[model samples]
Target: MSEWFYQESQTESFLEREFVFANFLEAFAFMTKVAILSEKNDHHPDWRNVWNKVYIKLSTHEANNTVTDKDRNLAEEIDRIL
Candidate 1:
């Protein structure tokens, strides 16, 4: 497993990963999966979706910093859904 979704950068407080689906249904399904997992973990992602694509950014709001274990874990979970 990778330690990160991407390399941590000083200019940004979070790490982002983009995913594309074949249709809106697939995108929305992935969003719903992320939402459920976020609720369960009490960690939410900053996300946006349009048509068949979704962009996800993970961060620990309380830490106000780059990627952490929580973010990496969530990113992996999201990847599984994709």
Candidate 2:
């Protein structure tokens, strides 16, 4: 299986991750927490959820879709939440 974070598909301009939980409720709860954190930081991730899984893509739009330190830091924070 792939890791929590990886270079998205054949691209390096974005960092991507997938988190799996037991059920939809757990997944939504995690998304809620991340949403709050994203709002506070003003560095939201491109994310989606389906069933028990959450997929996140992080990149700086201002930097031409490059992965920046903000993305790395946010990834770290998300790891902590897990």
Candidate 3:
């Protein structure tokens, strides 16, 4: 997968990804992992969950709407967990 970090805005660009899990348990497990990483890095993702699906949109709040290395790094971590 490409490690491309795009700028964040009040749009849905960051929501266009393919993340699938077999069941709710698997999805919740991934979310738990992500939550820990987010706390460690102090960078949270705007996300929602419905059953087995997770929607993630990341942005650097202190950096306005621009995407930074931190976002990419967190995304890598998330990909690893998933």
Candidate 4:
């Protein structure tokens, strides 16, 4: 997706993006919202939050940790969450 960056390792590929919030609480709230949606869609993200920033990475683990349509779709949904 336009908002994400593509990354690859020797054995895996993923899409990554970053979001910044006004404060830690705001960022945590956003992450909670994303977690619920991820569970509902059965597609969880690899993510971390520090202070006001949330970094997210998406990949389909069942697909050998590669980026797939599932990752793209999830990325779009995550954007909507923002």
Candidate 5:
């Protein structure tokens, strides 16, 4: 998953990525879109925002914090939003 940076710890494995935007407003707007999408899919990302960048990580908490089809699907949809 070159498009995503994969990470693992004793408790979890996740897919992480940074989405950059032209400005802070753009990044926040994108996050709003993602919030809608996440609500629809019932899969929310672990994310942080700093100015023009959004750092996202996906892991299935119910699946013991591992990446699953839901994570991949959400990641793809987020990419499409870009």
Candidate 6:
């Protein structure tokens, strides 16, 4: 939700969010949860992790990598994972 930002450019649009954890283990656990959610929803996210921080971007690949309802819904679900 409020923590997520919408990013757009000439070629793509996506919902972006960053999460910081107390340690790398916590961050990895968060990513694991997200992975499960992605599989259940059949919507994957582009993400990167470094130490205690994880950055994520969500978009619909079939929709030309643009932000869509699917992205929004998945973002909401991601919020709940916290």
lDDT of each: 0.80, 0.84, 0.72, 0.93, 0.94, 0.96
Worst window of 10 by summed lDDT in candidate 2: 1-10
Tens-digit per-residue lDDT, 1-82, candidate 6: 9999999999999999999999999999999999999999999999999999999999999999999998999999999989
Q: What residue pairs clash in candidate 6, if any at all?
A: none
What lDDT, from 0 to 1, does candidate 6 have? 0.96
Q: Per-residue CA lDDT of candidate 4, range 1-82, in tens?
A: 6879999999999999999999999999999999998998899999998999999999999999999999999899888877
- RMSD each, Å: 2.3, 2.8, 3.0, 0.8, 1.0, 0.5
In angstroms, give how far residue 14 of model 2 lies from its true place. 0.8
**Cα error, candidate 1, residue 42 (Å):** 0.5
Model 2 Cα lDDT, one tens digit per residue, 4-70: 4556534448888889999999999999999988987789999999999999999888877788888
Candidate 3 lDDT by residue in tens digits, 1-82 = 2643454457433422445689899888988998999999998888888888877877666766456677778888887875
Question: Candidate 1: TM-score?
Answer: 0.82
Q: How close is candidate 5 to the true structure, as a TM-score?
A: 0.94
Instruction: List runs of model 4 lying over 4 Å from the truth.
Output: none
What candidate 2 gets wrong by more than 4 Å, as runs, is 1-4, 8-12
Better of 2 and 5 by TM-score: 5
Alpha-carbon TM-score of each model against the true structure: 0.82, 0.87, 0.79, 0.94, 0.94, 0.97
Name the regions of candidate 3 deviating beyond 4 angstroms. Answer: 1-18
Question: Residue by residue across 1-82, what tens digits does model 1's lDDT show?
Answer: 3533564667567778778899999999889989999998899988899999898888887786667889878777876765
Q: Show pairs that collide, candidate 2.
A: none
Top lDDT model = 6
Q: Which stretches of model 6 miss by more than 4 angstroms?
A: none
Ranking by lDDT: 6, 5, 4, 2, 1, 3
State the lDDT at 33 in candidate 3: 90
Model 2 scores a C-alpha lDDT of 0.84
